[model samples]
Target: MSQEGWEASSMVSLAAWLEKHKEQLIATAVQQLSDREPLRQHAAGPVRWFFDSLITAIKDNQQERLETILRHWVSMCRIPIDGEPVGLLPVLGVFKRALWARLQANPPDENPLEFAVQLDTVIGQAAEFLSKVEAAALLDEMSHRLTAQAQTSAALANSTKDHFVSVAAHELKTPLTVIEGYSNMLKMELPEATNPRAALMVQGIESGISRLRGLIEDLIDVSLIEMSLLNLELQPVWLRRLLDIAAFEAGDTVKQRKLILDVKRDTFPAQPIIGDPERLLQAIQKILANAIKYTPDGGRIAVAAREINKFIDITITDSGIGIAPENLDRIFEKFSVVGDLGLHSSGKTKFKGGGAGLGLVIAKGIVEAHGGTIWAASPGYDEEQCPGSAFHMMLPLRDVKSGEGMAPAVATAIGSLANAVLERDSVEKSPQKATSEAPAESEQKETPLPVPVVPSKNDHNKDQTKKGGTEGGEKS
Candidate 1:
């Protein structure tokens, strides 16, 4: 077949694959780029549109159109304020890569390499040609990228960071335990100490400990999420109970805002969803935390969870600085910061809220791990013109069916755990639901860890005396 003819057929194949599985393609590409840098806070719609245009350019067999599309894409690519250049080449290459991958999956009648070669030539030309045009915008980005490449180390070195953090956090546990024990001892020993400063100082230390503990937990959770070590103890849970817990947690955040629960208690259904309630609660709290950070003081935050069809729809709408439409999709990606300056991971800057940028990412990971889905929406970026933002998390109310909810492996992992819980419930007839209170102190164990006995001075003395007596008896 002629080169032109091959390109035409290849375009058709690519379009078919995209139509059937664009999300999968995008997901594959995103996962490849995720660890390297933050994702652009744009929805997948723009991404799909670009892929469609590339397909059209190929079908038309027009060099001018292809260059035009490629140039526009370079211009639209948002650079980080720090000018850390994103791998522009790798991102642009995703177009060709997706086509090549799909072709290999089905082995087109025409040799797939022919299409791949043609794509490679154009993508290469676009990268070299457009780099000059966009270099000014990418100067800082490219410089930083070069520095990173130069300093790149082994894979183990990359993971050493999380491991070190985990170790440091563990080390803190011993000291924290001691502090709690000593502080309690002081409080009990001096119920009315004359020096009031002693009490105030202890109060301050306790407060700092609480904050440090929270930070440590967040760091540990991040490592767990990254390693896929965060296990879900799955059970049948009521969706409302999880949402309520999330709302209550949000109320504790340092925000002067009103939380509105939109669901009518009388009409709300017991959304009997199979999930790890603790993981689900954490995910919901992360989403609400984002809302708190983005919304300004005196903002109105509305939260609701209702049963829709077979899924529980939990919606959080905030009357604060609305997200830019392009940024709505990016918020869930790890290490990404777009839209209003005050994102969940924004640092201690006065204007933007402080964060580690892991909240939504962890939330996404947790929700997906639980066989649920999460997404965001906004009118625009302008607070006055934009009517604020809303985040929706959809969780199944029944046992997730095959071919519909989660990918088979994720569903299987979580579903198997849920099944175990259900089976245990059937056998034991347990009464623990989402809202059940903890068992009484009499019913619960006092400690989870085994206490080690230390030998006292008196015990050592007794042993020595017994040894001496035995020696005397032997001599006699």
Candidate 2:
């Protein structure tokens, strides 16, 4: 239909009628709305605006203006009246009924039926707009609620898993300790000189007990890492010393496997860094152990260090089995296994040996806690070809007196809070005790602990030679 024809006759007449009976129209709507609790509770301002805008749109013959008015009405309906929607159907009913009653009571001068049809058309358009908007708003609210619930559930699950691991580790420690003590006593009483076979059996039992102890410690460390309670004692430490200790611990394994462990000491700088010696040593040991496990017998494993600006990059490379491209990052995750689980054997240095897969995770945590980063690189996975893998760990070089050094809280133990509070109270109660406990003025200056001497490659042979010389003297 032409805009002028539709507006000039039907719209103009409707506009004039609404202006003439505006008060009566509103009173009828209010009366009908009062029957419904939700619609009745809403403010009358939006309702008044709806009618006013409608009358203006009709008079101006602007369909766009009318659409804008209906949209504004829909927006008002979006708000909750009493934590519930002010039912659009009820409000639509009230307006339709009021308009229908007035039209029936006083029919228009020209084509009353036509005017009734046009009014129904406008109300139907309003109903369509309201329904579409309500549907979208409901979907948005449901989406938000579902996302929040999923996040909450994930957090709870993680917390429960960490708690269970912590409790289980602690419970297992007491019995493991008792077993280790008894095994040590058995080893001492049954000397290898007399009961050689029995001694070998006890030694096997001791070896199993040691492996169990290591696994239990790994579990405890995993729990601490999950809870973000992995504490470090930051101090001035020589990087070489830490590497030496890790290599020394693995010396027997290297010999047993007939592997070459070449640690390049000349490349290391004389400078020291601010870090936890024990924890750093543990991280290096784990990486070294991982390299040894994947390498074949008589394979070459090299450890090298170099300075990079304010950091030191320690690289340990193994020439055994390489890692696949896809599994490099996944290897650092908890309980992650790179190779086939079915072929998994239980041994630290055994080829393709399987572990709880927590060593790398603990190492990563310790390195990150010290403001460092670690990663691995490999050409590709090949058992027969022996394509190797290299792990690079970068640690920041920080002096003990530097302002950018780690805070003392990094070393604070979580379980010492109660003891600290009690000590403070005791110090307050007895000032003399506090004074006695305090260091003397001459001893105020702290001294760094002495770094132990690293074992030379031929030290093992030198020890054997010294034992032989002593036996020769005894026989003479």
Candidate 3:
């Protein structure tokens, strides 16, 4: 048929055709909704309503209402299909073409169904395409949200673990320290003849207690570091004196390992500086202890401090197993042991230690807390040459202001604080006398209270030797 003839004929049949098609469309939509898919059921009511609205608009010849209803119907039809519809594609295509032909007929201006069918055909395809794009975007958004939630959950778990370790360490440290302190007192108060085995047994007990105490302290420090709560109590502390105290405390360990302890007094200033003495000493002790532990017997370990402009540079260099270049940067990380150092078992480098691998981590944390910097340097591992490791700590020196005194909350114990002050004085007078032997037994007897013989390096080694020094160091 000719285009003009078809247009005129379609116009005459349009009203009747749309009336029949509307019924068919309603029937098909109802049938589709009867399927198991919930989306189809949801779309069915709206689809039937649109068809009814279109039919009413066409009957009344309301052009605007017909256009609006057709547009809405096409938009509704765009809903994505989850499963196959009851009717086949060919049947659906024929109905769609018929609907389009009625719209293309361009009925009289008064005809309300004028552009409805054409609008539905074009709008339906566009809406369907847009719906697919929106669905894809929503899926991507959901996926990203899930990934972020998982990462947040993992981080929270790690934080909880760290908190648990910290709390456990703090709870365990106080009793262990008290046990060790009392054991030391017992050994000193009792005479060898009173119970020869008494002194030996107390020494053994003291050694174990000390090691456990050290491990607990390390864990607490690491926990504080992780939480960013490590703060320093700065006061007037004699830098040289603190070094001597650290050296004294570490003397037994050094001697046990047979490492040469070369402490150069000239390198540090004699004047008192502003800092946290106990925390500083602890930091120094941890570094020295690690050096002593790793270095072979007869190795050379030097503790030297030199003054630079406004800072005191304390360096501990040891002839021990040096760290690899790649692992140096990560050494200060929490529970991070240097890989390729062969320090851990299984020939793999890991932070697998007795007390949670917290020594180095705590030392670094304390140093940083004090506004100081601590770092390790090594020449790498060389079995033939006996590679060396060096730890350097730098602290700024500020003049002590008048009226500044130690805070009441800063001291760990009254007796220890007093002892620390006296020990500092002893070191200042003469460095050699500081490391000298204890008074003779006759002199100790002069005092009614028996003076204790503090355990020496030999005493500590006696236990290690019995256990076989080759055994890996025990953590808490």
lDDT of 3: 0.61
Error of 1 at 14 (Å): 46
lDDT of 1 by residue, 179-226 (tens): 878887876765546757777777777777776666667677777778
Compared with the true structure, all predictions reach lDDT values of: 0.60, 0.74, 0.61
Q: TM-score for each prediction?
A: 0.48, 0.66, 0.50
Residue 239 of model 3 has an lDDT of: 58
**In candidate 3, how many Å is residue 311 off?**
2.5
Residues 219-313 of candidate 3 have per-residue lDDT tens digits of 76777788888765555556566566667766776676566889886777765565665667767877876777666678888988888878888
Cα lDDT of model 2 by residue, 1-476, tens digit: 12333445678888898887777777777666665565654645566677888889888878777666765666564434444556565677777888889888877888887888887777776667667765776687799999999999988987787788889989999998899899889889989999899899998998888788788888898888877888865545566656566677789999999999999866766555667666777788899999999999999999999889989899999997999999999999988888888886667678778798999999999899888999999999999999999999999887534424444442232124335546666866796865676678887663432232212223323343222211111110
In terms of TM-score, which candidate is strongest?
2
Lowest lDDT block of 10, candidate 2: 467-476
Name the runs in model 2 displaced over 4 angstroms.
1-42, 45-77, 81-83, 86-112, 118-133, 192-200, 251-264, 293-302, 317-333, 336-340, 375-390, 401-476
| Candidate 2 residue pairs in clash (backbone atoms < 3 Å) | none
Report how far residue 241 has shifted in candidate 1, in Å.
2.4
TM-score of 3: 0.50
Residue 213's C-alpha lDDT in candidate 2?
A: 79
> By summed lDDT, which 10 consecutive residues of candidate 1 come out lowest?
467-476
